[model samples]
Target: MQFSANLGFLWKELSLPDAIRAAKAAGFHAVECHFPYDTPAAEVKAALEETGLKMLGLNTIPGDVAGGEFGLCALPGREVDARAAIDQAVAYAAEIGAGAIHVMAGKAKGVEAQKMFVSKLRYACKQAAPHGITILIEPLNTYDVPGYFMTTSDHAEQIIELVDEPNIKLMFDCYHMQLMQGDLSHAIERLLPKIGHIQFASVPDRGAPDHGEVNYAHIFKVIEGLGYKAPVGAEYKPTGSTEETLDWLKDYL
Candidate 1:
């Protein structure tokens, strides 16, 4: 039940080096990013080295470079695009020494799209395996990502099972699952073995722990009780200053 601050959004206010410094100063042992490719791998590595922070995770395929939307992996008819995206991710991960990569499922069309998506994932996993990196498939909530593929942990679990590789596992985001479904504890208990990574945000508002309905202390307790030692990603928006918002988590730690 270690904590990690997601540097994707909040860290934007600070330079990468300072962001890692701030996260470490704030009592976090590790940090994560959404798309570190936007920054150079050397800079990211340097920052991690300077701040004594572990690179917990980051996205393997972060969609288009220009559009800022639309992922390549889950697109219905884009195997080439998907492979290129995965290759870029593998290179980046190797360069920065990241542990896992969250493989986002792009927009879903129908049955054909899903089949293609699964095929692409299998390929990505094979490509990433040799790099000593694990591929994590996440399920986004439909409300936030309508028609987007991989909206359920059950679906993500099935995909991981189908991939049948030790390096491929589910990135179970508590916020998304709580929104898409309601049973947080049950889902975690059932899927803990298959989950290689975990993320969190307060439900209903996607804000810091205390600002939303989900009781993070209880959740942390459950996670700890289950003996899951992986870092729990703090992927939420701060309602106030990031420092102020994290007061609620101090007790749990």
Candidate 2:
């Protein structure tokens, strides 16, 4: 149960290089990001080299560069755009030595839209395989992303099985799962084999680990018992400063 930090919200506070160092200082083994495509790969790679930190994962197809709401892969009818997005992610992952690409199944419209979305994901997964990167399909809750296509672990699992590829897997986000469905332990137990990545945040509020409803210590223990070796992503907004919020993880670290 190694830990990783998300750099999406930290960019305002730290430079890419400094963020990596800060994450290490705060006791994280790796760092994750939403979109690093805007930054030069050489520069990002240099930062990772200097910090001696690993790139846990990054989103391959983020939506609006400015609004940060849309991702290419689940745009219902934009398969071409989705492929291009996957290509960009593959290039960046190869350059940064990242192991996984977080695939967002954008807003869902209807059954037909979801079908199209799944097809697009399958194509994206195939495109990502040659780059030696695994794709992590995350299920966002309706409370945060109202119409997001992939909104449950079971939904993601269905797509993973349909794709039938070893490189494609689900990103079990504890916060989202807890919000959409309450059986966190059972969901994890059943999906452990197909999960390639995991993320955590307190439920109801998306705050730091100990501030909300989810029992992270027990969740971590369950994950450990299952023998998962991947880094667990800390994708939450601190109620205060990042440092102040991390106190909750002291016992585990």
Candidate 3:
């Protein structure tokens, strides 16, 4: 199975350009990031070209980190801000040749919130379509982000169904799904069509996959059996150094 070092986590110690180089050195065919806005698009593009690695995806900026706002797309009366956020990500993705964008739906509730999320996604999908970039919405466990709007694979599936946009898809993170709902094999079977991207780490403590409660070896087979060709993201916090903890993945690299 192909793997990706989620630069947001694996290479936090390096600069964005250096992180891309590190991922390539670590034997990753591609990479994804949380937020790459701080680094200029030109610089990021140059690094990818030099390393000959694909930047598979990136997340839209979470709104106002200092103010505790996780995302704006689903916030009431934040329509303008949310669309502007989408526009920025779309521009960056286009410039850097990224394949997808993760559209975050932060702290939201009720029917109105869902409606707003759908509206924002509709706009995102439209803007991203011409560039051939997929728009993804992940189900983050509330345990990690207390009020994150999308918190279950079912919830994301439901929202995607409601939006009914071809470009909009699920960013299914196994760690979050295992925490919120543990039936991963079955979940993968049922949601395969909607899954645009997948990520994993150890469950419970969110550490290296090798020490986790989840058996990633079996999970890797499961993913392959399901015909998922995209690189699986290693989105975990290291117990020690990022490179040292990767002994578990040495063979794959």
Candidate 4:
């Protein structure tokens, strides 16, 4: 029942290095992030060294976020930018000793978009494989991200199969799955082999897991039963201070 604090949401107010320290002090076995590119990789590595916490993974930068583009890898005519983003993420992850990267698929649809996504993911896998980093594709819920290229577990699985790279894997986020699809326990069991990492947050409201409609206690038990030894990512927005929201950690365990 080990956990990884998702610095993107848990320690939103701190600098990335300080956030790493905070996660260590809070008893997280490891840490993961959405974006850590802003901080120098040397600084982040030093912090991880000081805290003795493994950096599980980080996401590729979403291109032109201010222009309403959540990601670029799936968008046609953006291969150059998308590959640049992947290169940046892989380099950063290598520098900080992270084991995986979540390659985001922007808002897009239709045949070309899917083709573009598969092509870019192949490139990403090629770039990451030598470094021993896994390429993760996550399915964002359409409710939270309208028209997002990926929205279902089945779709993600198909994309992974299409990519046909051993390094490619799924980033299964429980909150998004609960919104777009239910039957969490069964889905986990079915998708266990392809899953590289697992993340969770409260459903609908996207808050602490303690008050969620999803019974994380049962979910945690299921994960344990499945022999998932990797740290389960705590990717939730705090209902209050991050520290205050940790009662669920002890309760679930």
Tens digit of per-residue lDDT, candidate 4, span 1-253:
8999999999899999999999988889999999898899999999999999999999999888888899989999998999999999999999999999999999999999999999999999999999999999999998888989999999999999999999999999999999999999999999999999999998879998877689988999999999999999999989779999998777534
Estimated TM-score for each candidate = 0.94, 0.93, 0.98, 0.98
lDDT of 4 at 163: 95
Question: Which pairs of residues collide in model 3?
Answer: none
Off by over 4 Å in 1: 64-68
In candidate 4, stretches whose alpha carbon ends up further than 4 angstroms from where it belongs are none
Candidate lDDT scores, in order, read: 0.81, 0.81, 0.90, 0.94
Q: Which residue pairs clash in candidate 4?
A: none
lDDT of 2 by residue, 42-149 (tens): 888888888888897888666674664567676766778777877888888889998898877676567776677678777767877887888888888889877677
Supply the global lDDT for candidate 3: 0.90
Q: After superposition, how far is residue 32 of candidate 1 from its true place, in Å?
A: 0.6
Q: Rank the candidates by lDDT, best first.
A: 4, 3, 1, 2
True-structure lDDT of candidate 1? 0.81
Q: Tell me the TM-score of model 3.
A: 0.98
Number of clashes recorded per candidate: 0, 2, 0, 0
Mind sharing the TM-score for model 2?
A: 0.93
Cα error of candidate 2 at position 98, Å: 0.7
TM-score-based ranking: 4, 3, 1, 2
lDDT of 4 at 5: 95
Taking all chains together, the TM-score of candidate 4 against the true structure is: 0.98
For model 1, how does the per-residue alpha-carbon lDDT over 30-104 read when each residue is reduced to its tens digit?
Answer: 999887777888998998988888887788555664564456677766778778878888888888888887777
